[model samples]
Target: MMFLVIAVISTSIISTSLLPNESSHIPFLNDDNFLDWKDQILLTLGCMDLDLALRVDEPPEPTNESFAAKKNAYDKWERSNRLSLMLIKSHISQSIRGSISLSDKVKNYMRAIEKKFVSSDKALASNLMNKLSGMKHNNSKSA
Candidate 1:
């Protein structure tokens, strides 16, 4: 049963990437608006790790559990948690990569979202955003 769930989740992730480029909305997990729900939850967890990193003056750590969807079928998706973590890592990487096009409003909104998962100062999200922006700028300059 557990293996079946992992297989399904894995297949879904691949299919999500391969799905036709239709503009139609599915009322769930569409790519047009923002990251999918799974990505959003993972990003929130990543934000928590980012907060912890700042407080401890260490690098961010992988999530243990909060990213789970808490559904009965999760046993199948359980193994995919590692894959989910990787996806979140990629999202952060892509977010940083795309930060050059991110508007101040978007950045602020994302920072606010990150703040919900963090316990420390609300300012840290801004700080992280600034750092990411700077990094993106530097990368573009070098390219």
Candidate 2:
């Protein structure tokens, strides 16, 4: 009995240390990090098994006559959407979050995020193009 107790305590300690910290975080999204943030968010949600809302379209509302599987799918989807939205929103910068339209669906929320970043990306590309076009060989002054 003493040996059994010691083994149990050791196992519990090891498992506890191996588990992810409750406060561990995905980094907050900012104007410059949308691409990396989007990837990390999806990866984190997938690891947590909470990505159903991102994988499938929302189901029609279940009814008294609905099949058990249908009800189950909807329940899973609803839970995924709710949790995903919370996680995504909580990890975003307040300024960015305030600008994004509210979305009850994870897939749509991601789409909205991508749209926000797309403009930034376009502006960056334009700025780089302008700089490249303005460059001269300067052979007259260079060694």
Off by over 4 Å in 2: 1-25, 135-143
Model 2 Cα lDDT, one tens digit per residue, 61-115: 7999999999998999999999899989989999989899888788998898898
Cα lDDT, model 2, residue 84: 90
| Predictions in order: lDDT | 0.41, 0.85
Q: Kindly provide the TM-score of model 2 when superposed on the true structure, using C-alpha atoms.
A: 0.76
Put down candidate 1 lDDT per residue, 1-143, tens digits, no spaces. Answer: 99999999999786455433332222222223333543554344443332222122222233565344444234433333434334333444343334333322332334443443343334666889889888734344443
Regions more than 4 Å wrong, model 1: 1-75, 94-113, 116-121, 124-143
